[model samples]
Each structure stands twice: as structure tokens, then as C-alpha cells.
Target: MNTLLIFIGCGLVTYFSRASFILFGDRVKLPETVQRSLAYVAPATFAAIMVPAVLGDDGLANLVPPSPQVGAIVIAGFAIAKTRNMAVALGAGMISLWLLQWVGL
Candidate 1:
């Protein structure tokens, strides 16, 4: 009924929005200006998420676990940069955070 129709409508919209890209990937080209802007998307997106987390009241650092979170994230970033292994980086980072918090450091 109403619920089912709502689901169907949402699904159709989602499908079209996604499919529209594939359906016309090569048919349309973005201008050079737009292309350059698109290149900033990843850094912008990362900052959008990380900036708020790292900075809090008075723009002070809000380390993970409120103390060693910064250290953990640094370790994680380093691991990711050096090894390029996501799971290892995340696992090490999270473990470091927990260990620091657990030890009451």
C-alpha cells in the first residue's frame, strides 16, 4: 500500500540517479575547471570529517579517547602511509587507543 509505494518510489529515484552515471559516462565530459575542482573532492571530504573530530571547543585538539586519540590517529596515518594496509593501520590505531585509555594514560 502506501508504504510499499513509498519504497518503490525511493528505489526508482535511487536507481535512476546511479544508473544515469553509467548510462552516460562517456557521452558527457566535464569542463577543465570542473575537473580540477573534482580533484579536491577527496581531501575536502576527508577534512570535512576529520577536522571536526580533531578540533573541538576553542578549536583545541580533541584526541581520540580524548587523550591518546591523536596519537592513535597519527600511528594509523603513519601505518597507512608506510604499509598502505588499511586493516593493519586501523587495527593498530584502535588497539593503541584502547591500550592508552585502558592504562589510564
Candidate 2:
């Protein structure tokens, strides 16, 4: 019962917070530079999350020997560069990782 109530409270908070933007967006005018900078937010956020996970605690040291993960990232990068398709890049990365792991790196 307590958990359910807590979840409901949290959900309502989140909903209201997000809805506030839509409710008041017209009145809140941001600067052109701020709006332009917002475009980089997603990619920056993605890199922030992925960099730590990919590099792990050892950081750049993990790239010394070129692990399966690094190989997959390289393949995925190439796929995206060549095809310009996110799905293809994802598939290429996943497949390369699986293959590398299966072959014992």
C-alpha cells in the first residue's frame, strides 16, 4: 500500500513537471543561442552515459588492447558512416560484438 502510494505520488510529480513546460512554453521565450545549443544536448547526454560504460573504471586503458566492445564501436561507426542508417549501425555493432565474443576476442 505504501509502495503504491509512493509510486503514484512520484508519477504525479513527473507528469506535472513535464506538463508544466507545455502549459507555459508560450510564455517562456528562450534565446536563439540557447535554442541552438539544445540540439547538442541529446548527443552530449548519450556520450556522457556511454563513455563511462564503454571505458569502464580503467578509462582509456581499456582501449590498449582493443577489446570486442571497441571493435564493435568501430564497426558500428563505419556502418553509420557508409549507410547513414541507425538501425544498420546498431545491427552491425551487435553482430560484430557477438562474433568477436564467440571467437574469444
Specify the highest-TM-score model's number: 2
lDDT of 1 at 39: 84
After superposition of all CA atoms, the RMSD between model 2 and the true structure is 2.2
> Model 2, range 62-91, lDDT digits (tens) per residue?
697877888898899899999999999999
Badly placed stretches (over 4 Å) of model 2 are none
Residue-by-residue lDDT tens digits, candidate 1, 1-105: 699999999999999998986887788887899989988989899979986675656355454335677667788899999999999998989999898778876
Q: Which candidate is the best by lDDT?
A: 2
Worst 10 residues of 2 by lDDT: 53-62
Q: Which stretches of candidate 1 lie over 4 Å from their true place?
A: 1-17, 53-66
